[model samples]
Target: MKIFSENITVPASAIDENSHVNNITYLKWCIDVAEKHWLSTAPKQFQESHFWVVLEHTISYKNPSFEGEELRVETWVTLAEGVKSERSYKITRISDNKVLVNAKTVWCYVELESQRPARITEEIRALFL
Candidate 1:
């Protein structure tokens, strides 16, 4: 599986009372980056055949991500099985390369009309390739 890596800055608004990035904000960033990467790299593929919806998410925070910190988020497709696919993310500090977060998410292919889990068609596989 290919890994996609991207960088982002920690915004002041993303900080929490603990003076670091809020837990939910980290999860949101993971989702945002995955969607952005898919849209930018395969817009037609994404629109035509299928969509991946999040089924479950597991996140572990290793270090505090403070305001003004630069972050590196790396996403990788682990596997696609049945109607579900798995992706993993590693969030690191850009300045020192310290890992700040580790996250895993399961996505299910859903038929738009029936709103049911659907198989990932060949077309969808080709897009992710």
Candidate 2:
């Protein structure tokens, strides 16, 4: 499977009271990378016609990361069918290659104007494949 990846440096703003990257920050990163991949790979017409909404998210925190750490976030679409698909992510600390987080999110496809559930088209699936 082809994976889309981005590297991000942990900033002070992302840290929480626990002194590590906050849970919410991880979620934000996941969505950001996913959206980026979709926008960069999908056709313009498809992009303007469809949007996605998170239906579910399952994340595991395996390690803690500190400020100034460079993190590599990699994501890929695992399933695409009907009105929904699944995307998975692995966030690793760049220096040590420690897997800090593993996550999967279920997203529902929707029409941009109607905001109603839309079926995934063959062309859209091909873009990811």
Top candidate when judged by lDDT against the true structure:
2
Report clash pairs, candidate 2. Answer: none
- Give per-model TM-scores: 0.89, 0.97
TM value for model 1: 0.89
Clashing pairs in 1: none
lDDT of each: 0.84, 0.95
- The sequence of per-residue lDDT tens digits that candidate 2 reaches over residues 1-129 is 879999999999999999999999998999999999999998999889889999999999999998999999999999999999999999999999999999999999999999999999998888785
lDDT of 1 at 90: 92
Q: Model 2 segments beyond 4 Å from truth? A: none
lDDT tens string, model 1, 22-94?
A: 9999999899888876776665844566677999999999999899999999887777777987889999999
Q: Native-vs-model 1 lDDT? A: 0.84
For model 1, the stretches where C-alpha displacement exceeds 4 angstroms are 43-45
lDDT value, candidate 2, whole model: 0.95
